[model samples]
Target chain A: MVKNKIKTVACLLLTLFFLGGCKKTFNQPQSNPEAVFNELWGFMDKHYPMFAIKEIDWDKTYAQYKNRVKPGMVDAELFSLLNQLLFTLKDGHVTLMSATDTATYLGFYKNYPLNFNLANIKNNYLFNDFKKAGPVMYKIVSNVAYIYYASFAQNISDAELDIFFNDIKATKGLIIDVRNNTGGNPANAEKFFSRLINQKTLVKYEVIKNGPGRNDFFEPKPFYISPNGQTYAKPIILLTNRLCFSTCNDFALYISLLPNAQIMGNPTGGGAGLPYNYILANGWKLQYSATYTLSPKMRNIENGIQPNRTINFEPQDENNGKDIILETAFNTLSLE
Target chain B: MIKYYSNKTVFLKIGLSLVCWLAVVNNACAQTLNPDLYKWTFTLGLGLNSNSVIDKNFSQLPYSGNGLGLSGSITYQGRLIQQQLNLTYGMATLQNKYYNSLYATYFTANYSPLFCLNNASNSAFKILAGPQIAMQYARRNYSGFVNNNSSFEFSTSLATSIEISYSIIPIGLVLKNKIAVPVFSYMQQPAFGFATFFANSGSQNSVKNSSDFLVPNKFYRIINNFTIDKQLAPRHKILLSYNLDFYKINTIREVKSIHNNLIVAYSYLL
Candidate 1:
């Protein structure tokens, strides 16, 4: 009995010596202009994926912007200055989402032809005949399935992909139009392209920023596109425009790699960079890419991916009420 | 290796102190001590908690938020040794209002030994020290065009606590105060941003380093708690408590969180 009691005492003492112990801090941060600007600028300097690739001198960019940032600047002026900094990166994925406004870089299409018009397509091609599933719109034209995917972010359910493809399986070929599809989920890009390839294909390589230093990046890791559970052998004509970016850019590049695929129209707005957002000390939010994405050829897609056959739909063709991109895709696939 | 050696030294020193105390109690002829006379008490509590996140990843000063949480503990009180052993578990979920659509949840399990200054049934002062392991998971859900951003972290802390209790049996009122501080911790935080974690077949590189622990100057947690018990019978009581917890770390970036809680509980002593 005494031995048992001593053992119990020792065990209790030992247990006592070994024993132990994230959060919503809902309080608003003190808002300040200069501090917020520094947070935004510092984040990009350290993590933005395109500094070296774009030949941007960030320190010099900081010197120029910091001169414009005043401590007493209001929310609008601060937001304008910060948005201007992202605009300098010329990446569409670089966005500032705030209560009053959302900012994005549209320089990709500012100097280029739109290369796509919804009104023109609906009047000439779709003609109230297009079927909608998720972010995909489809219509049959001259024995071809013309499917328009408006955004890469829009998810296509397995059932939707199955039904949509099954409905159009008898067509002679496919025209996948992604013009004006700015971007969305990159996973969707891989998934949508996976439906075209029967085997696993390496679509893109990714390099992640590890440290705050401009050049600190892990070695490129290959991102693969696994077969998306469906197979099609018909030639696919993937259309593009300058506004197509990020995941959109990725999707166009992946399709362009397929043996039976052809890419036509303007080069995409390069947004292959993956953007993440952070709130400033003043609760203003800033968005910028931290992950650098590259094409299968190891070319940085931030400068946009060039199409195999760059075709501009002439304004005269649109004035005559014609969908020139669609007409070109139909004519090209009709020949195949 | 340094942590292993220093913690071992701490165990040895405390073990020696306990053995000496046992020796003194055993030699006291006027008092007889029995280990079988120890009593166990269990309490279950639900709390309304308010908190703030100070992660540099979020904002300069993370906004304050509120949450509901549950806590329960099993305590063994030694009448002869004038000591107690407590094992506790607690969890809470909080939302960041300023950064709308973001949620953070925390889970912690703690074991601590209390050395009473007086007899267990009549003690007013106690000292406590122990180790705690904790984990946190946070999510910033879909906002505008971006969706499903999340993060997870794990850490271990060495905590020391001081507790005081006052009881007036005739008035059926009992009050207790405890303050605990974690002097050091080793923590692991994800290197890449949550948005970079792709939703489909997303790949991540996980690297383990003692960098947070090696820095030595980065992390801390302080907890203050107050409890009041109103007894209706010898075996049953109503308990109310307020807990204030504050934590800060600067591993990859500066992150801080604070929680204030008001708890109501039912107590059972056996």
Candidate 2:
């Protein structure tokens, strides 16, 4: 009886060993052109939070673009058709990426004046003698600190900021020029903002899509920045332009909440939505704004944030090897 | 040969040689080495793992790929009980139908105790049953998705385990098969479109909110291991093992993952 039981047990284990671990395969969406188009449209319809904000009738967009995507259409034709479909949103945050190329809307900053001239600033203001701390390029121009922050993508560590603030202790005021900063990591901007605030300050509000309904959204949640690193409480002028976008826009908005800071230059290139990405069945990636952001006054600041004072760049002044925006920031600091 | 030694001295040498030869023969044929003397063992393994995952929250298509990794274990083998602790880490890639790949990494630790059913018997076959506790953390990342590209899970499971081993005396080999099924688990999976803000929130509650206790119907896991052991010396062994793990979570968005591994290891008996 013991031998029989052992034989049975061995056979049962062998059977189980052979029978297990079958790979599961899920039905993939068809790789046809029309099917790809429908997948893209359906995802955007369900998850894209800015269709209502951008005043787009997605069903009408589907009606207009659906016929353009045929079953036998090639990849290039399908890509172009999808590009046209995405263009109606007029959002800088939206993009379509394939193996060969990436397509995005540049009208946010392209149609406006190129308010920033790097060569002019480099030649005259932030000359070769300027000092670098993290992503910040700084030099005292006429006793006022000129901090030319080109992009928010580069990190400014707390230690680097401490060194930067200590170096500029003798300066009368600071000019923070974020003219062409298209945006990078928001945490970097938050870290930079933390130096200007003494207490926890509510900077903006954000709402996310929770349901598939066109109007479905979570209540706007408050975003705050608290004190961190070395505090610089001196008069600071934040310069902006049409090219300042994403976290650059966020930086400008946060600086406006500080009593010692003033925003100069044109309205910001607004891209307030938090972008999210999805992959289509054909391996193409589609990114769109998935959340809405509001200014402190509960106003829609997606188009752009208005500056406290408007400053413009001058080509004539560029011919003289000077950036008029920097001069304007200097004059504003002098008044302070 | 020569009269160099007296007959008495020669006889003494001859008697001593005979006794030594007989002792050697008796020791060689005895086969009475006690395993209980060497109860503790340490094993180090190198393996390759192939995985297939279908996470509807991340994507509808299944991502399948393989990777190479290493594992280490410590085991105690008493006369009628065995216990082991195993730790493993591996990195792999999961590719969709369109050839897009997501980077996957995983770490696991498991502890099991088995009681021998027929340890007192002289039969070469043995059966053991016990419980296993396993904890695992896995994460998948894709660079293409800017904000919601990463997804991760942490699970602690209690499982029923059984092992069967048979010794082939002629070849001096032992073959063992073990299987386990998780009865219940505490698992955490993020909500749809796992937000980047929550990842940087630095709040423990955010992690707790995504966790829940799950039963068999909602969370199912199974593990099967087959191994061949050869005793190279009284204090050494070489093992070849194959292990399979299958896990699935049924929620608003269902996710299923399977791992197939083949390992070669060396065990040192102490």
Model 2, TM vs. native = 0.77
lDDT of 1 by residue, A205-272 (tens): 87876666777777777877777665887999888999888788888888878999888888988877
**DockQ result, candidate 2:** 0.15
Highest DockQ: which candidate?
1
The number of the candidate with the highest TM-score is 1
Model 1 lDDT per residue over B93-155, tens place = 434455454465666555555554334332222233333333333332334324315554556
Q: Model 1: what is its DockQ?
A: 0.23
Model 2 misses residue B183 by how many Å? Answer: 3.6
What are the DockQ scores of the candidates, in order?
0.23, 0.15
lDDT of each: 0.68, 0.78
> How many steric clashes between backbone atoms does each model show?
15, 0
Residues B177-236, candidate 2: write the lDDT tens digits. 888888989987765434523422311222112567888899898888888889898888
